[model samples]
Target: MPLGTVLVTGGASGLGAAVVDAVAREGGRPVILDRFPTGSGHDEVCVDLVDARAAEEAVREVSQRVGGLDAVVTCAGTDSCGQFGDVGGEDWDRVVKVNLLGTAAVVRAALPDLEARHGRVVTVASTLGLRVLSDATAYCASKFGVIGFSRALAVETQGRIGVTTLVPGGMHTAFFDGRDEQYKPGPDAKLNQPQDVARAVIFALQQPPGCEVRELVITPSVEGSWP
Candidate 1:
């Protein structure tokens, strides 16, 4: 059977957009939670995921409107690369708020609905989540936090809801568009296509009842981030 309504954070672009398209191709309805509308014809809720309360309310509202949500994909993320002290305090905090707390808020809000439908959640972490690097303090911390959160959540929600932690390496997206030259990957750098990475999410979501994909790591063959 086709998957039911799927809620995707950051569904406006990059990896999330790919997931949205994949869900649609598989005969599922996709709804978006983004700071701006994607114009891809999916119903989109424009709200910053940083506000935990607002994020949760948005999820509830969207879920109600969509009839019910069968899955949630948290692919929204932000990064500010620089020395720990070089980045502004608020700027650094925003990364943590958006990447870590934002992920938690949406999942927490969607839990009741997911439990009702025995739904799945795909939380997007990063290769950085498993390793340390220079000039990416905020991004690293937030993704690492996401990894920890997804693991505990899986344990807590086992036998009820499916939780999958996605450890994705670099992708060819605007995620690096505004980065400083120093932070940008080299021209020859290899990165996975967003669509390819998103397919992993679909695989997790399509698992038969009582089966779950607890963790998945996907990257390019020549990727630098994944060891």
Candidate 2:
């Protein structure tokens, strides 16, 4: 089937924005749900994903405006760098709330419409979910949870809807902005671009109805080993 309306969480910037533009380029109406202003002409809904009620309302509003929801791409996430021992309980909780719980809210809110349309759900997880890194406990934990969630959801859908988890290694995004030297990786390290992962999401969405792409792990070609 042809592409239809797509809802993207965190679509205001970074990889989410790339996915939004990709969908638009592919003849799909992009409904962006984000905390910041996307400034894109496509339908935009500004709301905090951490707020369950607000997320639900945003999904409802966007789905209503778009006529129907054909796909969802969740790119809303945050990260912190601190040794497991140094990270405080509150910090861990915050990361989980944003990366895990926030995604849960979006999925819950959009599942009904997706079921009706037999659409796709694409989640932007991290390669950290597959491999552990020092001082990235919270990030790894949340992404791991995302992987598990996607797998379970895929099983529950039973081929009715496409569910995919995108695991990208290092990306040249603002995810490292405002970080201390110790908390950030070397800039020279080869990294994947947001557009690279966006393309993967588009690929997953473009597959035929019966096909499902469960997991995609994308890393920089030059980066032979973990960064």
Best candidate (score: TM-score)? 1
| Stretches of candidate 2 exceeding 4 Å from the true structure | 224-227
Clashing pairs in 2: none
Cα lDDT tens digits for candidate 2, 99-125: 887888888889899999899999878
Worst 10 residues of 1 by lDDT: 1-10
What are the runs in model 1 whose C-alpha is more than 4 Å off? none
Candidate 2, after superposition: displacement of residue 132 in Å?
0.9
Best by the lDDT measure: 1
Q: Count the backbone clashes (under 3 Å) in each candidate.
A: 0, 0
lDDT values, one for every candidate: 0.93, 0.86
**Error in Å for residue 128 of model 2:** 0.7
TM-score for each candidate, following the candidate numbering: 0.98, 0.94
Candidate 1 local distance difference test against the native: 0.93
Among all windows of ten consecutive residues in candidate 2, which has the lowest summed lDDT? 218-227
